[model samples]
Target: MATTMDHYDGFRTFSWFADFVGLPIDQVNFVLTQFTALILAGLFRSSLSPIAATPAARHVYGLIIGLALGYFCFGRQAIHLASLPALCYVAMRTQNPRNMQRVVLAIALIYLSCIHFQRQIYDYGSYTLDITGPLMVITQKVTSLAYSIHDGLTRREEELTPMQRHQAVQKIPTTLEYFSYIFHFQALMAGPIIFYRDYMDFIYGHHLPGSKSLTIFYDKNSQEKEIVLEPSPTLVVVKKVVASLACAIVFITFISDFPIQRVKEDEFLKNTSMLYKMWYLMLTTMLSRFKYYHAWLFADAICNNSGLGFSGYDERGKPKWDLTSNVDVYKFETSLNLRDSIESWNKGTNLWLRSIMYERAGRNKVLFTYALSAFWHGFYPGYYLTFASGAFFTVAARSVRRHIRPLFLESQRKKTFYDILTFITTRIVMAYMTFSFILLEFMPSIKVYLYLYMFPHLLGLIAIILPPRLGLSKKAHKQSAEIDLSETISNGNAHKTM
Candidate 1:
């Protein structure tokens, strides 16, 4: 059996299963796509490691994740995930950890789990609804709002500017450099889904308030390494240039071997060599980070292909005067893992999703939380059931955590090989749960149904790995209510005055 990859959900953002469903047409339907786009953007930001961690980094991560959501909900489904944000009270309720907060949080999680399970039944298992039909009136409003900021929000285009061209001309073949911006079809499929806050930091970050001071934000007088987007028309040209180069690179590399469809078990055993299979799977796992970057880079290149050194930050925390992160945009590419994932991709919409949907769902009402997630993914029965199942299992896992923390603590004190073994085993199990949705996406059988039926098994499975609860008292979540308004402000450029 092939080992599963990391962030495989990127592929699932726009599920192939949705292909067997209907496609939305017309201005009304098209406009409605924005809701889900917004929600994906929202969730992408919401589900990240907050911006202290560098809002720009987290926002960029959100944007990457948002691209997938936009591809799924806006690009595919008529129902926009953000359209029903008002209904997603659980997603936003993170700060209020009241009495018995853990229990409340768990319950909310369960509710969300159930709802998400329903999505598996509905969206994934071939049930389709124009869902936009019922929300036409609301969508009309969304249509208007979308128009005002849609171009600014999605920020399309990928090509370099005259200076970028000159730089390229100075380096290698001009034609090859220009070609890099267009062929990344993967990016065209959806969006740049960058975090609003991180984008903000990349721009007006120097002027930012609070801890981002030169003493803290940077010691240099010229935090000029920052990539402040040109407020003028030049940005469009720059993006086009950068996008063109990135596209050209991907066309030569990725499109040549676009593994569009997944391999079935039997076909894999017979046709591909073990080494090749290992390589492919490794690519799948590692490329999740790349897949994210490719989408964003194309969008960014499209925005910044202009040859001006308006401002830019290399993937490192360092700002570049005009540095090249790519030797070829192929041989030298930054591969972002989970940590980086949270940093770079932010969408404006996820703030609401987290501040609204997932956060609102408490430790007690996980079912509602799953319900909200299911609704976001789709109104399909399979999606609802599958997601809910995941939530139920998540709850069970929490119970297991209650049991495990103490023992894990005791074990941590000893600092033995057993701790390493236990830690790895725990993480592996977590990883499996993380990608369970990916597995369900392809399997399409009663066995998948069976897994859904045993959704609680997630709890059981986790407990099997985690130590049993030792009656540990729950401490108030100190992380709650600590709003870095300045940091939050810096997360998204669109939101700031830049």
Candidate 2:
């Protein structure tokens, strides 16, 4: 045990900085390496432009930098990062073309699951940084790439969705390019999970806002023309960085005061007023969310600085740099329904769940997606609890919107009131659900929910059991057809029947 401890301790070259910052060495390294990547992103576009002047150059540069950063941050364990992806690439090359998606997904998920299992057993409930973080990101990248490749190779273009067609990989990437995409420093740590096709486009400069292939215009004379516009990411990067800093500040300020573990304490659970417990849950969960917001925003800024996240110009002709944005702060915080809230938070992973899992499911896509999400997250009992709760909440939220929301939509004042009501309700629901997610243990999660009277779960059950007709008369149901409850669900794959 001492030898093993020394082996792990050998990776602690940054112990001085860790000590100075009053954080674990691994965490200090995670943040410091990202700061290093951010600085490198600027240099890659400016002083190091020549090194990244061509697609091949860019691939090599990213691979080298990413590998170095991974090793520096994770030491010998970092080898696991490249090995899994390389094995998956080999599977893609050798596996039956039709089974490629299943094969690769299994390999990635199973490999990641083993690591997750080891982590859980080794340091149960600890939040210590490990190679598992990058492995999770890599699993998404490789599995999504597998599905996209299968779509391109086996499925007919006519049968594919427009987004699928756009993302499908027509040709298998060269080994170097595949590794580069897998290891790209911009997203390797905490990703928004860029698609293989999109990453290639970014590398080749084919999807820049100013790229002719991406944007076009018509002249006043009505002649066909291309409108080229230069888009700078300075504003987007600045705003995201500032927002991330604010999130970091809020997290640092309140995390210790309202740690999620407080709810599980025997004294608090046994003595605290239910109302105060609810408030505590809300505050702590919100603070926990800020940690993700900070990391995702910083990762996004790195992508923008490296000229990789430019999507296109908006209606007002301002550039939109959200191609790889993981979260939308406004929509995420203010979402009035489960569908919108789920879509807003962890936007990339939601997209992956939609395209890769839900869209491909034969039936019960919602349940299947949730199950796959729970599995992908880890073997944690609390993860399963959270996702199971989310599935129920999804059904209830949908029913409420379909039945109750239309009654309020008829009047603007009522609509405003409805929005306000749903906003508060959604936050509370999210807090309740996220409480388990933070605790990440079966007994603690169950204990807290039990203390809270499990009201949210019961509410979901009640909402689901009560028929839509109970909340809406036949005439009102007919009248509310125009309400378009389906519109709330993103990606057009919203399960309409259930």
Candidate 3:
């Protein structure tokens, strides 16, 4: 007989209404978690805002809520919660920056590997129910904290880059503070990976002084400049929450009917025409994106409700709300190229990879970063296949854009036509490339690609090889080799801004 862990459906709940209504157990649990966090955040903002303004109070409150939720969700297994603080303590103890980074990353990778491996062997099909997901979020936090500490303590101020200086951890936080940041309930689940400096700024209510109009005001009388607190924009939070919940409802209603596994069936491959197959793939990919859209938008709302995601003001002086936004729905949908599409989707994770991995990886940064991404996701062979294919896709797309894009730019009408063609091509290529990511198994993904005649893969190879021969210099292509990972971190500026 299969073990309970092997066949778990993720519907653990005590409410009779849930059973009576016959709701999906997984979705019910997800909604319960999101709503619970939202309510707690509102209470904290309204009733305890003054007390919670203090870092210590905020830390204690976060710890209590996080512990309670962990126990409620995972029971005795909540004991694993100790691992995060333990790792953070060890990182703090290692005073050497390089050593600290190495130790933290090693421990996090090992822990995540173990969890992912165990789940693969035992809990293969249960999506959104596994404890490993939360652990993965924790992995990002701990590793980032270690690197931030290294930037602050190990490297000289002059030696650091602008992004590095912005994220540098000036002081070693106490165990309590560290735990609070790691277990912050708002982003404890599907996260936007808040940086150490950003979290500290939120805790201390210190908005950085910049050229922007929305500067944080300070009291003049006090020698130590005290930050004036702004009221949490409840209206903005409400709008985002409502929108995200709607997206979630749509996904929950349709995702079951358009199951990704349907592509693997003989009827789907054999009976469908090429155009129909492509259209089906696009629809499946679009539906798949809604799941992420819901999670990310809901997470942003939770953070904003507690006044955590406020960055500054736009040119018109309207307050910007997206400090932890993960996806740009408009850019993701209308992207004319792979770079724009990838950058717009999972904005937070890409930022993490850029700041931590891509910048550090030297000559072969593109390949290195892609490999790290594959590793970070988990042990799925399909993940490796997708990333490997993506590497070629990037090379081909860059070649095409560089050599072909300039030819159409002479006329606005030509450029418009070019953009339209590229947009459609990008969507189809993306759907084909990411099909494996949803499938998660090697043979299924391979079979589906074979059925599609491996058109995109072959096209990508030809595109890369053909570009230079057509008089696009090797020098021109050399500049495109580096992944353009840098993006402004402010709201509504450009790519990668949350």
Candidate 4:
């Protein structure tokens, strides 16, 4: 029944449905919606006064991710169980111990609804899991594995039987699409991966407000970096927002062009114009910029929004921004000798990085973080190439920069023609990497082109975009903080509003 024209028909149908439902057909709408929602969702988690730490926030943050997974896997015919994450995140954020039972029940009810609804409209294909699918997979896999090990020690008469304590392994889906919920493209579609373990601690772990740990291999000493909130409310709360927005937005247009990402098998045979090359870069980076800026924008927005009324310090007597994105949530926010683009952009994700890989990896934190980050981007091929190429080269660039730091720091090297070439090269590389990511994200076709030719030309470009330490703004810094929900919630029924 399929034909050459089926693709066009399918695409047209999807567009009509999206437009009818007021969903964005382009990547820009996609970026803004998820990024803005996630920031708000993170705040809900921070306000939970979590009795225990959990990735409950991702419940809310995962809403968008769930939506995409549902639509893609189940098609637009029905809503999927992914929306439960948002609701769960919101419910968990409520500090009332009495609400626990209600939260559980609500979660169950919502999940059941999605499961039944999905079942009726969409068959449970191998890949098409409902709410309990992932949990069941993990549960069965672990139980069966444990049972196998237990049965080995002794005979059933003398030792534990698999049924008594062990269980059978659950069936796995053959198609990836059925379990697409796990590989959320919307919630974390553009951002970094946040593990469940780390997410939980933020909600319930009751350590010091800013006591989470962060270690980076990039630092020779492997010192733990603690984020201190600067006392200048106006600066952290207000001024930097505009900068983050500007820095994020200008490049967004360049990233939104997702079509540019498809790796072309052979170079376009007709390509001869400089204008073609120019459009290629512009469209690709636009997509990445949209996502990058959206994350920065929302984080900044939440912090400022929460910092609106109560002017108070943390238990440690440090100034406060919004605890939602505050650095106090992590162990440290240390400095590295050389700054790279991916690291820089992700660091802008607030405390998510610090509490995860940065703290766990110790000295090799940057490298570890970068590698995982690249992988976390998606189940895609080009992202790994971009991430690995960028990470290694950036590390090398940092090492080389250290040698020349004295030159820039001491003002020994003036901006000569050669220096300008280096500057242009670095910036162009930055632009190129950013462009490649966006293109792959939107277009998918450009990845081959990127890997074959553009990626190779980026060596000189790296030098251009990297900001010398001298150029880094020596502004007042703030220490990150953990918050009590009573304090962070909007007096306007903070928890209740959601």
Candidate 5:
């Protein structure tokens, strides 16, 4: 009983519901698709257990559902989504085995960059959810899988890192398996970038906690032979669902009031006080994070609900379900160091960049990885500005922590005061960096930086330049005792806090 329409509207014709929800139809469509995926995840766990559903049937089901969701969200543009992955799969199977990884990486980046270029030309500054989001995720999956396959097939065991060894794909997957890994309904739309090995393990029920598929010791008397059952994901999924709704609520309530674009307006620049401007910058950026938090938490919940994200049990025997988590909410909010803050957010991208670029880059890994990150984000001038600044900022932050943090370890009181100062400094610096990232234009970002006097950049440069001139390295041994004592106290405090 489907109604005929003159054109394929990407399931974006829900104006009545949009009006009721007080959001654009496109956003409504995206939210509905996510919620629909959540529902399907529940059904996947309850009804399509490995005992009930064969691997082939599961693969076909996922491929069909994922493609339907793609078309329903992006219409004809979604064809690129399927075709790009299919092309990569073919290349992986037929291309020169020695160069498969490099070839696939080039193809994925080129295709994604072309889409980004087209988007910039056609729909610049529009915040509409589109095929590009999916393209970015697909690119990550395609490239990572290619690298893992190469590691498995081309490299010797001693050459591979422990993680690379575990995740490497020894055998070329069947077409069904490959498509299902990429287009699985739970992770297809937005991913935490599941590795090919992890996805295959999940599909085969090998990912379940305490599953007997991978026995470590054959000895019956072994202490590690105790059986532990898989735990239900109900509590974790419920918690994540609640967290997502809360983030969405905060976003809906505060996003309009603290619009980042307002900082660019003449009215705000002229009328707003400096203190108010600083406050607005921090608040707006903080609000901006909720959107990502909501998306990632919801996606993680979807994966967990389908029994995919189990890591193992904790020491207290509570199951840990964060294998696919993309954000560390507490550390993200409370970190006193820029490095920790950056690592806490968009964690999947950080891991992917570390694995695919940083580890492989022989020299200047940070610069290369940051450059690659900016490129992967697209051709936005503001992205380059932010990442370029980020590269320096990271180096500066690292240098400061090494040279200055030990100086504050003379007493617990001094350490606490230092933490307070750094917490505020880090937040302001993060907000300042994020301002350019959000604006996404050269002139606007530069204008805002000019408005703020561009002090963070100056401070970061000073942080980098002043340390060597001051001979901080010569004084390292003098502070070693204090640093050791401070570490002892901090570990005790951390245990107490936990």
Candidate 6:
């Protein structure tokens, strides 16, 4: 047994079962931890429903589960968990929103700095994968909290964007509550990045009540406000978990067959036809999405199981189960435009970027937001490469949609053909653009792009230059820009779904 386990050493230190199974430890631990969270969520929901649903009780329950899981997965490294909440508490104690925001961001950056420093010193070539994953989620939560506090306390309500207004943190939570929110077991590792207000509302059962005033499209025949009781989310949770399990199985079973790194291989580049190469890239990108699909769906199911993802009814009076969904898998797979593709993938992160960065940037919001997103992701050069490429892609895609899409939309057949063309184009462009993000290194990413002929980059340049000459005047450009920005930022209805 010891000899067998030694062969599986990578999967041994974390758990006895992992050692017994002789599989990679981190993978086993990750899957097991997610499963544990699901079980705990169900237990907590059933045990605490209507009886111990106070904020304090919820906080205590969350803290216990989060800390236990942290220790089980990370052991002594779990000590680092205290640092974020400690700094956040200090920020709250300052009682000044500006100072609080500054302090919280500073502390979060310092924590990230320490993580990078440790990676450089000890694990230089390991790529800093799962070990620091939770820290990214923590960074988003802390920064969002700080910003929300500022919005509520310092900024005038009239000046705030609709999202900022809805997510404003009116009071400083108790230390226990703050820590619980930060370390919520469901979202601590993989997240949908719930806002502080949304989490608090769920805790107090206030989410369902405040929906009447919010925008809700009713069916044309329905006039009466039917008092629909909030349905139990057990069914929703089960469905999502099953879907996530399927994604996980697909990733495990097929990812090796469609290796992303094969694109960089000399034989593949030299021998593969352009048509086959495009197909390969699409398949590789689709496979890459499976890992994220599993994580986000699992997190969504956990939140729903705990009754934290309730967002009230839809147009047809059906309950919405996507309040905490990070990805709309169908929309992501079939996205007809760059904006929709980007927004559909990692939606929670997009919501955070739009709310915290895009809406606040004074000039060049798109550039600033993408830059901030890259920086927030990490120090990887490939991240910058992807973001830079993404900026061009967004411009080209938007220009095409604005100037060309209307021409085809006059008839259903034309629109269908256009949608199909755009869908394929979007996938290919995105796959080409984001290959670097998966690779996470500068030279390798550039090498792959070069092998692919860099047609997308060249096309984007042409779009940028030709748009203005094709009746796209400066005034029209500005108006188009505002329309795009409004579509992303100023749309209050978008916030509700997220």
Which one is best on lDDT? 2
RMSD to the true structure for each prediction, in A, is: 17.4, 4.4, 4.1, 17.0, 5.3, 6.1
* Per-residue lDDT of model 1, residues 1-498, tens digit only: 011222111223333333334332322222233333333433332343243345444434434543343444334442233333223223223322222223333443344445445545545532223333223222222222222122233323233222222212111112221111211111223333222222333332332222223223443675534332322324443554455446545543663263422433456535766445444533443333343344344344332331212244445644332211111233223311121122223322222233333433556444654564455443444354455545554544444434443333444554354445544433333333333333335343223234335333544665555543233444312221122233345543211100
Ranking by lDDT: 2, 5, 6, 3, 4, 1
- Model 4 per-residue lDDT tens digits across residues 403-439: 3432433343552533564554455455555554443
Residue range with the least summed lDDT across 10 consecutive positions in model 1? 177-186
Candidate 4, RMSD to the unseen true structure = 17.0
| 1 or 2, greater by TM-score | 2
TM-score of each: 0.37, 0.92, 0.89, 0.42, 0.90, 0.88
Q: Backbone clash tally for model 5?
A: 0
lDDT of candidate 2 over 1-498, digit per residue (tens): 112233242257768766777776766777888889988987766644432388888888888899988888788889899889999999999987789989999999999999899888887877777788889889999999999999999999998877688889877889999999999989988887988988887777666744434466777999885544446678888898899889988998889999888877899999998899989999998889999999999999998888888888778777888889999888888888777788778878887887788777897878999988888888888898899988889889878877777778778999999999888889999999878888898998888888989998888888777856475776667656755644534446544211
Question: Which lDDT value does model 3 have at 167?
Answer: 93
Model 3 score (lDDT): 0.75
TM-score of 5: 0.90
TM-score of 6: 0.88
Please estimate how well model 4 matches the true structure, expressed as its whole-model Cα lDDT.
0.38
Q: lDDT by residue for model 5 over 140-233, one digit each (tens)?
A: 9989899898988999988976667887888788988888888888887777888888887777667866543333443556655433345789
Error of 6 at 383 (Å): 1.6
Cα lDDT computed for each candidate against the true fold: 0.34, 0.82, 0.75, 0.38, 0.81, 0.76
lDDT of 4 at 16: 51
* lDDT tens readout by residue for model 6, 455-486: 88888888777865787555555655656567
Ranking by TM-score: 2, 5, 3, 6, 4, 1
TM-score of 3: 0.89
- Candidate 4: minimum summed lDDT over ten consecutive residues — where? 475-484
| Candidate 3 lowest-lDDT run of ten | 489-498
